[model samples]
Target: MDQGFFLLFATVSVITALMLVVARNPVHSALALMACFLQISAIFVLLEAPLLAVIQIFVYVGAIMVLFLFVIMMIDMREAVLQRFLPGGNLPALVLLVVLGVEMIVLVFWSDSFSVATPATAGGGDTIRTLGTTLFADYLLPFEAASVILLVALVGAIVLARKEPG
Candidate 1:
């Protein structure tokens, strides 16, 4: 039962991710990205991380996706959508994708690191409290860095969307 749900969520996530990359319209791509994020949240639920699942849906699907759609709406994408790709432009990407897929398969099948292991028991404390403490204490730098990166991206989008006065 759990395995079936996991497979369903994982497959939808992969399909939506592919749609996000291949969709020509920026709005469609953003919608696909939102679908991918929802599928990922479902996977987090299957993994018994309800808090993470909620955060995924709230942060990625709710807040970040809204921001993405706002940016997409602000930009004029007609030229971008109508642009032609250079001949065989995707060949290099296809080759890289194939190589990475083969490498991942080899790693999954042959690497001892992927072997099943005993699951670790949760620490004897409030899970959310522990997570908050760890995030602010141990991983504070990375957390703040990610926030700064997001801030920069938001500002960049605003600047790009601004109309220039003649």
Candidate 2:
């Protein structure tokens, strides 16, 4: 049962993630992203972590997606953004793709001898208690600093975009 669920989840996640990247329409891409988030929340439920699943659904699928959709809909010039093309043009894109292919080949062949080992952590599943503890203890200052920085950046961007009197 769990294996089947996991496989379905993985397939949905991969398909939606690809669609999110490949979809020419921005609104469709955002919908794909929302699907991805919902699938991830379902995976969390399958993992027996209800809190993470709730957080994933509420924070990512609900609030974040609504905000993104609101912003996307607010944009009257989405066609212009969609029609925008890459710089250095088609030749550079093809060359870059070739370089990426070579890099992928190198990574696959050269890294054959190296194997990644998982870290030996005691608790595997995420818990709200532990998450809160770590957030308040080890990462408290940095998290607070990041919040202030994001607030400042938001304010600055708004200020910069504001029109001046003629």
Candidate 3:
């Protein structure tokens, strides 16, 4: 990977991520998230993982962004956006974010090879096949569990939508 291109994508990714967090409108946030995902996909491409790059674009940018947009459109967030934030309403969330930030900082600074990229191996030619084999052979249970969990969430969403708001 060219250092200049890597730096460009990494900078754009971080900027877009920050934009996603700072954007007031949910739709704008989703768009910023999509930009961040695209930049990360470019980074994946630089790493010679075309399959992951494509999946990032198709799954995260395309499908997940659409889902976010749909949820944003369906919900009434006008009042939520207009309301003033109370001091302690978000304390738990702020504390959780601080904890996550500390953990990420520790992981990045503590690891000796944090800045080094793994050497490319020979058998990465057939990425899709390799991904499928690894998914089914090594990670089958986790994969199935994720699918089941998503299914349950979808069903729950449908049921909630159909229920009366008594």
Candidate 4:
């Protein structure tokens, strides 16, 4: 049952992620990204990380997606959409994708790290407490720095989206 659920979520996640990349419309792309995030959160739940799953939904699907939609709405995309996609323009991307696919296949098949299967351990009662402590105590500076960076980006987006009065 668990394996079936995992496969279902994993398949949906992959499909949504592909949709996110392939969608031409910015709003549609953002919606696909949100769906991908939601699918990822479901996978996290299957992995027994409920906190991570909730955080994934709250942070990625909620806050980050809202920020993305705001930026998308602020931008004028009609000109971009009107531009035709040249077939030759995709050559570079296709080459990179094929190279990456080959690399991933080689890594998966030849890597010693994945040869051994490790037993899954049950989470302790203090799992969340330990995670919180570690994040706050050791990673607080980096976390705060990331937040500040995101805030700056949001402000920058707003400024760029603002039009000068004639």
Candidate 5:
């Protein structure tokens, strides 16, 4: 992976994640979340996992984000309460951020692991074909479980969106 592009995607991902947390409007927050997901998918591509990148875009950004937007739209936004920012509320997050920064610096400057280049595709058939075979053959149960969970979540969202009986 190219260091320059990785750094750019990482920076954008972090900024958009913070924006998602801080946005006053729920819709804006969802939009920021989508931006963050896109940046993350780009980072996945940089890591030479195009399958993961496509899944990230389609699953999280396409389907899940649309569900999030629908939920946000169904809610009464006018009745939403604004939270007051306490001065000390973010201390734990700040500490974790500092630790993450130190870890990144150490990884970039001292680690030899990143010096090695990995092949873009694993074990030789077409990338998508290999992925499909592996997923359905080796990981079928887990994949089906994930799909069921997503289906349940979708049904729950629809339930929540339905009008209440008077």
Candidate 6:
């Protein structure tokens, strides 16, 4: 990848990720995350890693983002979550956040060092064929489980929307 393109992606993606976490509104945060994902996809393109880029967009942006939006829309955002009632319990949350911050800092600096030279398994071609084959063959059980979970979620959501007896 060209240094300029990498730099551009790094700057934009990092900035948008920061904005994603810092945004007060959940919708804005999701949009920022989408921008971050797209910039990362562009970086993958620059590196000739079209498979990763496609997966990033398809899984993260397409499936995961839609899930997030569905969750956001399903929840009653108007309900106030009292600070005292929140699960974090304040002090522990602060400590966890600090630890996470340190871990992210270490990862951001050293991640490039972890790249390995794995020999390509398939001929240079569109990766969808191999991905689909693996998804349908070896990982079929987990895929079916995921489908069941999604089905349950859909049913539960409908149940939650029904009026209860007084």
Leading candidate by TM-score: 1
The lDDT values for all models are 0.82, 0.73, 0.78, 0.81, 0.84, 0.76
User: What does candidate 6's lDDT look like per residue over 60-147, in tens digits?
Assistant: 8998788767765765556523322555566785587679768977886688743543334566575668878988999999999998
lDDT of 2 by residue, 19-97 (tens): 8866877699999999999999998887766777999899888886876676555554544566667766767756876
Poorest lDDT segment (10 consecutive residues) of candidate 4: 113-122
Error of 3 at 9 (Å): 5.0
Superposed Cα deviation of residue 49, candidate 3 (Å): 0.3
TM-score of each: 0.78, 0.59, 0.69, 0.69, 0.68, 0.54
**For model 3, which pairs clash?**
none
Comparing 2 and 6 on lDDT, the stronger one: 6
| Best model number under lDDT | 5
Model 1: residue 11 alpha-carbon error in angstroms: 2.8
Q: How close is candidate 1 to the true structure, as a TM-score?
A: 0.78
- Which segments of model 3 are wrong by more than 4 Å? 1-24, 79-87, 120-124, 145-166
Candidate 4's C-alpha runs over 4 A off are 82-89, 105-123, 133-156, 164-166
lDDT of prediction 1: 0.82
The lowest-lDDT stretch of 10 consecutive residues in candidate 3 is 155-164
lDDT of 3 by residue, 37-78 (tens): 999999988887777899989998898788767766665676
Q: Please give, for residues 87-153, the per-residue lDDT of candidate 1 as tens digits.
A: 8978898788779767866776797744543333367758888878888999999999999999999
Ranking by lDDT: 5, 1, 4, 3, 6, 2
Stretches of candidate 5 exceeding 4 Å from the true structure: 82-88, 126-166
Alpha-carbon error at 110 in model 2, in Å? Answer: 16
